[model samples]
Each structure stands twice: as C-alpha cells, then as structure tokens.
Target: MTRVPFTASCSTSIHKCCLVNTINIGTTSLAAFPNSLALPFVPHTKATSVRRISVVAMSDLSKSTVLVTGAGGRTGQIVYKKLKERSDQFNARGLVRTQESKEKINGDDSVYIGDIRNTETLASPIQGIDALIILTSGVPKMKPGFDPAKGGRPEFYFEDGANPEQVDWIGQKNQIDAAKAAGVKQIVVVGSMGGTNLDHPLNSLGNGNILVWKRKAEQYLADSGIPYTIIRAGGLQDKEGGIRELLVGKDDELLQTETRTIARADVAEVCLQALKFEEAKFKAFDLASKPEGTGEPTKDFKALFSQITTTF
Candidate 1:
C-alpha cells in the first residue's frame, strides 16, 4: 500500500483556525477514522515549523458469515447464490438435509447436511454465524391413491414425520434457539400470506395447518428479542423477478387485490435486502407484485422497507 504524507503548517492565527476546523484526506474525513487511530491535531497557538505525517489507510473490515437453511429449495438457492456472488460482503454457507440436496448444488465444503428438527444436529452448522435466514418449510404432496381424472380435488399429505407442526413450528423454533445460543446479529424469515385466516384453504391441504404453524413460528421469532425481518409472501410464481412492481401490505391485505402473487426471485431479493437496511429490522409485512411491465420495478429497497410499520 502507498503511504501518503500529509503536511500541516500554522504560521498565523488564521492558519491555526483553519486546521482546527477539519481535515479531509482524499474522500475520507478525519472524523471517519477509527477511535483506535490517534491523529495529530494543531494546538491553539500558531506553530513555527511544518509537521509532516505519514498516513496509512486502513483496509476494509471482515465480511459477515451468513448461513442459509433450506438452501436446497428454489428460493433458498437464489439467496445462497446471491450471497456467494457478493463475496466481499459475506461468507456464505448452505445447510441442507440430505446428501442428494448437497450434490444438486455441486456444493463445496461450505454446504452442510443436517436435520433442523434434531436440535443437536444444528449446533455445528450454526456456530459463529453472524446472520440466519430461515427458509425451511413442510411440503405437501398428492397422495398416490388419489386419481386426478376421477376426483373432484386431489388429496394431499405431508411425508411421514414432516408435517407442518414438525417442520414449520418445531423445526423453526429449534433454529431460533440455535441462533440465540450462537449470538447471531439478525434473522430473516420467509412465510406465506393468508395466515390471518384460521380456516384458509391451505390449512385443508393434508390437514397440515401450514399457515397456522408458520404464523406461530413468526410470532415466536418476533418474541425472541433478536432483530428480525418477517416477510409473508403471497402466491409464489415461477416467473422472472425485477420486471414488476413489488408491493408491501399488512395482515394479508394484499391478498384482496389483483396483485396477489409474486415471483420467487423477488422474494429472494427481499430477503437479502432486509439484511442491508435497518428499517427492515423488527418488521413484518405481506409481499406481492403487480402484473409484469405495468410499472417501474422496485429499486429503492430502503423506501420499500420504510413503508412497513407492522411488528409481526
């Protein structure tokens, strides 16, 4: 690194006054220096000689270590890839449940295989993490015996031991507890919209009560005393992101409008943006998007987060 030499000479009272006001080093101000670095300042009186000082600019601070649970999923994969792409900002790691999921990503050693439901299994993966993004949720699938051709509606069921209660509720609670133990700085959790209704149609899917359980986990995270951002996303679409205007609402209010669905990529972007802005902390809101090409895409994430005032 090149060291720049700064010179200060106070021959008159006017020169001393100018030195006391402020000193600008390139684009950095004197006040921006760390408290550990002691910079010389001119005394009240005028000096007789010029003082030359060698200034060595400091390097950038260390990057934060972030862990994404459920990195094997579609949205989680996006978040993990974004973090990795911004390597100067974060040290990204992925947590998956199976070897197949890990292989799917062609994951290096940074990817870990562990079950979130087993609290003991999460200890190692969660250690030393600066932030945690919870994306794990129970998935409902159609029962094999149900024939769509002969049925009014296909029957659904969660895999054995992977119901909403076990995955969304208990598993998320375990991750929260692990994060607390590890002293994580922040957490960003993604949940679905329509949680305000107790008898919503999603709850009837396999009787899993998915939204109810997800709401319970969100409430638990809110009460955990850690800074957090909770996003209750509307219907998830497989389309491209950043082509439609994103909207934020409270208590599923957006679900009543025509813009009730959002792309999975947009949701992934919001999860990352939440970590960049303090306004997103300790806030909860429903997220959706307008039809593609209707209006300008969302580029001001700080302003978007500022529009939300809900805590849960």
Candidate 2:
C-alpha cells in the first residue's frame, strides 16, 4: 500500500459525481472520481459500467481553531504538533494540566493550562473553539514502597495514582459540560477498543472495572447532542514505523489480530480528519491495523463512514 503525504500546502476542490462499476467479486459505486476509468479498463469492456461526475465545494479549514485536551500525553502532543505545523490551514491549542507542560508547548499562544477534572479550569480554553479532541488517559506511575528492580509490580502503584473513576468517567463529563456551556459544536474522543469489556487484561493492572468506566464515558459523549466521533483505538504503541493501512469496524469485531498497534501520530491524524468529516459526526467505531499487502483503502473518510449507522 502507498502512503499519501499530508502537506501544509495541500488543498483540493470538492466536486459531486455519480458513477457505477461492477466487478465479478461485487458491485461498487464511485460517487467522486477525478477522471473516467474506461481508459484503464478497456480490455474489460464486457463488464457493466456507468459514468457520472458531481461536484461539491468544501470550505478551507485553515481559519478554524481546534482545542485538544491532555496535550502533555503522547497522542495529544502528536496531534498538537501536526495541527500546529499545518497552521496555514488550522489553529492548534494544547490544553495541559501544568505550567511546565504549557512551557513544553513553547509559547505557541495556543497553549492553555487546564485540568479535565475541574470544570472551571476548562472555561477559558474552550471558548470560541471550533472543535475539541479528548486524548486524556490515566497513566501508571510508581508508588511508595514499590520497587520494580525487586520484582514488584510498579504498574499497580502508577494505576493507583491515575484513578480512572475520577479522571476517566467524571473528568470526561466535566469536559462535555464545559463544551456545552462554551457552545463548542464538534468533539472527537479517543477511547480504547475493549472499553466495554471489564474482563480485558489492562483492567487487571489498574482494577477490574477501568474499561467499564471508560464505557460509561463513551455513553456520556454519545448522548451529549453534539457532533461527535468516538474513535476506539486498538492496543496503542509508540514505535518508529509508519502507519499501516487498516480496517475499521464495530467494537471488538477486529479481534485476534497481532498487527493492530497504531502509532499515536496516526491516531492524531484520524482525529483531525474527524473534525471536518460530516459523515463521521455522531459516529463511533473501532480501528485496527491491517496486515501488509492488504491493498490500499480505496475508501475516503466519508465513504468509509457512510457505510455505518450511528445511534447518535
């Protein structure tokens, strides 16, 4: 599969089209095509084919300001830099919990220090924001009396410090409330794919119910009556490899796969895409990486999402 580069100078003119093509495997429709496929498929002229083109225009996203929470975390930091680097098309804001983190963002003028657990802290940054991306996740740290060198599980201590109850469930609620009050129209939340399963192994490290709490948070976002996209990512990893082309589907549908790890940078790209993808609004889906040579994902963001039905 070939990877498409996202450049700061990249731009496209939207057009509307209606086209039809039939293959022996199955019939498919192409609503938007840059040019006629007839020239390439002349040898297969016996196959059924239809041709049409429609055009629709989309406004430039460069003027919009996007607010991202948990800016100190891996995924949040990636999203901040990607959006900031494309400042010609997007205004990026990194919402952090500490002055040190604000400094890390290096006086971007878009950095806002705030905590998801406090509603008052969110008031300032959320104002006049066009979109919001929630990347906050409970991190594990070592606790007193725990020694990894001695074969002790320091993860338990870290999990204890990052309580999911206060940060995952309630903190998310606080964010939604603040968004509503501030008149924010769009939101994209990052969640885990196994969040509905309490029996998942990650929960064993923190508690039996960490995923359960995340499910509650997902439910809250669904009912918020705002334009939202909930991307439930598979096991996350931070590696140097490029993003693998992938298949996305309903929760837990892409299980038993070993290549599901997605880079934090790719997840951030999806979050940015969700901001302007009208078809992704009010939709929730799971994402997992596909194996090499799975073929390029022929579907664009809107086309892929239009196939799914959303509850909200």
lDDT of 1 by residue, 7-126 (tens): 443344333123222455444344322323455543332422223333332221356778999999988888888888888788888999999999988788889999999999899889
TM-score of each: 0.81, 0.73
Q: Which candidate has the highest TM-score of all?
A: 1
* Candidate 2 accuracy as lDDT: 0.70
User: Model 2 has how many clashing residue pairs?
Assistant: 9
RMSD of each: 10.5, 16.8
| Best lDDT among the predictions, by candidate number | 1
Question: How much lDDT does each candidate structure score?
Answer: 0.85, 0.70
Cα lDDT of candidate 1 equals 0.85
Model 2: per-residue Cα lDDT over 1-312, one tens digit each? 222222223124312121222222114442333322232232324454434333322223225678999988878888888888887667788899888987776746689887888888899888878788998877644456876679945655334435887788988888888888887889899988776566787777655356777778889988888888988888777753243675576767666666566666667777887877788888888876664456564337667667657543
What TM value does model 2 have? 0.73
